[model samples]
Target: MTDAPVLPSHAYVPGHTARHTEGAFDPIRASVREGMSSKELARTEAFRAGLAFRASGHFWEAHEVLEPVWMACPPNSEPRAFVQAIIQLANAQLKLRMGKPRAATRLCQIALAHLDEVRGEVVLGCDVAALRVEVLALSTSSELQYNA
Candidate 1:
């Protein structure tokens, strides 16, 4: 295991952050309107925060923050699939942290499947090709390391 990255004050990581006992961070307090454009959705604070949480090893919080953005996207659209892939990635990491390697591998496979639905090389700020490679590696790794 490696040291966790420094996260924003408002970011909450379950078991690691004291603030989680009070309440999980809710980046989306209300339902997001459906049919929002991918560019517009990508610009939202929730999306940015979600990515930040994931990068900081706060996988649970990242999934919580990104779910609304995923819900807001048009069904079957590349943006929806992209967000779903990210959410699955977060879940995969969380499962790894929980010592559930089988679950993590399954989730990584699901994430890769979702990635296939995306049409662009990049979605939002994520490099789709790079993400695919990362997820595939995670799925096959026998000994994975994670941050706190």
Candidate 2:
């Protein structure tokens, strides 16, 4: 339902850790689980690992790893938003490296949208203001410079 295409709950999303169960686990619940520390599965470690990968500039690698988390996130949940933002961020970075500035800018915008719902500056890059600035600059530059 989001503007972003909903990728099929693939039988095997490359970087996922859990089985793709439909309507089973919720992202907000999972995020709370990670925070509470009393849940059966400690997801904080897993999330931290993914963040580390993203920070290290391994966008594609981050995509591969964080996807399951995104898929697992239920609608209207922080986990869903967080994973969505991370995935969008990684995809944008990948597109940038591929020289597709338009695609990159759009993806960055998607990330910003997700960031708007819920975020931590230390965790999500100090909010979406910076991302908005970057994406707008790229989009404007691309639009003005390339009209072919």
Candidate 3:
């Protein structure tokens, strides 16, 4: 079998670094909120796994667990964005563990924005607005605590 094509890394760009590509969050939100996609986002085993991992401070594992759910989402669905935001939040926590608070903060900011798309709606068994506030407070804090 032929090898898959290699994608370029974003490391070469300064100040343009992001966990996800720019402008990719909006469509996902619109799709979910508007019911543009048929895929229903239930709190499945994978979702539970991600939550468990995040709660246990296994941030990277949480990201891994939630990714498939995000991928299974129909393109531009709110569920997709919500999962992606959770993944981003996990990533931010991981970055914080790695002593990169700035990166973590930035990722949290992106996550908060994504969360804003469906603030009042309960998706993935979470109060999206409350989570947004928590993340926002974390991002804005002078120092973030681990497993916070």
Best by TM-score: 1
lDDT of 2 by residue, 108-135 (tens): 7788788687654433223445644654
For candidate 1, write residues 3-89 as lDDT tens digits.
332355554434645445434455342424566678778777677777878878878878877888998988898888989998999
Model 3 misplacement above 4 A: 1-41, 144-148
Candidates' TM-scores? Answer: 0.79, 0.54, 0.66
> Which clashing pairs does model 3 show?
28-76, 32-78
- On a 0 to 1 TM-score scale, where does candidate 2 land against the true structure? 0.54
lDDT value, candidate 2, whole model: 0.55
lDDT of each candidate versus the true structure: 0.75, 0.55, 0.63
Could you tell me the C-alpha RMSD of candidate 3 in Å?
10.1
The total number of steric clashes, by the backbone 3 Å criterion, in model 3 comes to 2
* Predicted structure 1: lDDT: 0.75
Best by lDDT: 1
